[model samples]
Target: MRIVHDWLGPIELPEAPERIVSLAPNATDTLFALGLGQRLVGRSAFCYRPAGVLGLPVVSSYTRVRWELLASLRPDLVLVSTGVQRDLLQALFERGFPVYPLPLPQSPYGIMENVALLGALLGVSEAATRLAQGLAERYARLYRALPLRRVYLEFDLGGPITVGRGSYVDEALRHLGLQNIFSQHPQSYFVPQLAEVPKRGPDLFIYEPKPHRSRPREKVEQLMAERGWRLPLVVTGGDELAHYGPLFFGYLERLVEQIRGVLD
Candidate 1:
């Protein structure tokens, strides 16, 4: 058994958890990346990634937990992410369940650290260490070769919302040598009007479509046309850019390629 600190507090876990439940998408991805998918008996509805995990039983989401369903699963280790899950974590603890709440990572290095911490809890510290190190090295190289460009990244076209500082997306953009036009915003994300976007004079426009939702390039073009902003637009892999996970390094590489192509 081992004891580690989580966002909620200190918790004890078995040397190797056999039946695990992940409430956050990123945690579920980390379990699979650490080769512990077989042990993940329950996951949230939104934890679909790395494929083959869609069949798992759904127990909870970041903001909600099905107490009865979660209890029935009898998970030895229940993973939670900080933020809206705070109440869920407390409920599980009072119910005598071993729930581990992971802190929300706002930056790239914080994400890597969370991966390593998860690995330690899962008894695969070495694998997690290697994963973090490899990604750091790749990101370092990309940073050195990254192009200089001011970019406007939109996660939701309906509101034309964008990420700012304190978001992993912001860190990723900075790491790739791209400047986020909304980085100076006080909040992590905010909406900008169509007419307001052109005033910033961004060199590129990056749009990340929502999962299972189709927002084709033509739609993006239409949006730009409506706004009268003729900047080059690139649509990134929705889940890849939205998710902060072990595969994010791969996503980062792909993002760098896309940026290079756009800037060239």
Candidate 2:
């Protein structure tokens, strides 16, 4: 058995885990990127990456876990995310399950650390090192080329949900030379007073609508009308903005391209 330390403390793996269960979509994507898909025996409902994971046994969700089904699968290791899955992590740990919890990365460097950490845990450190190095180089290039702009980012339906300081999205925005209007807030993600938008006066606004859900254009319009603002607005897929997997690098690239198109 190998003992490893994670966000939830140290857990002992009986062996180099062959049958893995990923409870975080970002972890699932990272596993697949490391060519460890064959080791995954179970995935959470949200871990739908790598195309064929839909056939895997669904053992977890945001708030609930199928303990009976998960135990039946006999997973050697279970990867979980912090914040959203905090309660699940506690339950799994208390139940004597081999669980590894990782917090969502908050910066470009943190993302690379996550890739390297998973690589070390799974005995693929060499490959993970190469991947992290390559992604870091890509991030540097994007940051160097990015033009600074004052921006307001919108998530959720019609409300003023925004990325605050210390969030990964905030870091991503920093890399793009875009300043989040709510960056002054100490909280990571928060709902701000509506009056703050006009007082700050951002040059641009970006809206992210949830994936696979009907576009809530009316909500956006309603927000605009209520605020009486006519700033340049852009829409992006919510999943791409929120997910922290290495695959999200592609989404970040696209986001930069879109920003260049709109601002330049």
Candidate 3:
């Protein structure tokens, strides 16, 4: 029922990993997308999608994982995305745990590749491939349907952080012919200054506003409401903006319409 082979080399793993612990939200989402939600025994606190997974045993957060709790769960396979829980991963390994650390999916294809990796882990290769194909088709449609917009997308505004041109999110934006203003920012984590935002006045300031609270630019939004700044936007962030994993396609469609509203 399950196959354990690497994309390039030989790597042996169980046919169907009975107990899986996902330490990253995106990673957990990928597993769910592969239809292996039933196998998840441990999940990150940040993994909120697929609805019911919130009730799963919580072992990690964005910043840390409770190693004691994770170890007690005795998961057969541990999957983590890079950057978030490296320390916990080290502990897991030292304690003789089998863990798979996935590098950040830096590109659109890379994300799909990770999907394939997830499929293999879940022993649901066919299902995973189908999901990946759906995403590819959505991307192709978006790429052909629209023209590039002078758009600004931020992963978070608390720090005024944004994605660069070639980042995964930016690559996704490219599908809708959307260009990120931060694409102009230096590679890696680029933090934009509020002062820098107005001079060029990106056509749309698609910010990810925290649902209940205003972001770091709250005062600026107020000032702009009084019409101090020239840029206007339909933006997202916080819980709502986090529609990255499977909901990425949704984020793109909303972005396309918002950009259209600005252009029209």
Candidate 4:
């Protein structure tokens, strides 16, 4: 089937991709959620979700690929996401590989749309639609009655990274009736000024510690204390906010509960 992807342009995809290779964590998670995990032959080293995908051959990483191993896998379709993987997609396309690039979602709705788009590409439109609808329903049921509070959210991607406008994290926070202190920033992700954080007068601090490089609550408190900030803190310990997958909604639900506890 021929489809014009926003990033990949006009391309022909198989009616049903039997042997698939997903190089992005989100795509890998989506494929499994759609019940197409058996079709995957290769995955990136970072696609460690559902625990079962770890059994697949790791033919790629975030920015590098094992050409020989990928060639040996002989995937009929290769799934990748935009942003960091844009150059990888071009390289695969030029090498005559059937590569599809999923755009980086700007909002929660964009994530749901990608689920539907991926389903259509693999001839599972019905299942994809149902999944998207279910995700929407779940999002709607999230607690939004908490009193509005100014929030400062940071991610530890080796350093202090924060979300702003046009990011799914920012949108999700707003959906929960919390105002992001950096919501007016034009960029999606950027290094936040530590001085500005205290000046923002946030009622709560949501810190997503780097995955695998775990930082305990006491350590987080010490770090914040050094900055002379003693705001209520919620340390998210995993890649739930950093990852754009179906599991993200579940994490958001948990976050709402956490925030309620912190505020109350």
Winner on lDDT between 1 and 2 is 2
Off by over 4 Å in 4: none
Better of 2 and 4 by TM-score: 4
**Candidate 3 residue spans exceeding 4 A from truth:** 1-13, 211-220, 223-227, 237-244
Off by over 4 Å in 1: 1-7, 193-195
User: Could you tell me how far off, in angstroms, the CA of residue 197 lies in candidate 3 after the best superposition?
Assistant: 1.9
Assess every candidate by TM-score. Answer: 0.90, 0.92, 0.83, 0.96
Better of 3 and 4 by lDDT: 4
lDDT for position 207 in model 2: 81
lDDT of candidate 1 vs native?
Answer: 0.80
lDDT of 3 by residue, 151-250 (tens): 6655554655767755777666666676666675657457767666656556777766544455636754774577465676665545544434666666
Cα error of candidate 2 at position 236, Å: 1.3
* TM-score of model number 2: 0.92
All candidates: CA RMSD in angstroms? Answer: 2.2, 2.0, 3.8, 1.4
Candidate 4 or 1, higher TM-score: 4
Task: Evaluate model 3: give its TM-score.
Answer: 0.83
Each prediction's whole-model lDDT (CA): 0.80, 0.82, 0.68, 0.89
Task: Give the higher-TM-score candidate: 1 or 2.
Answer: 2
Q: What is the lDDT of residue 62 in candidate 2?
A: 61
lDDT of 3 at 151: 68
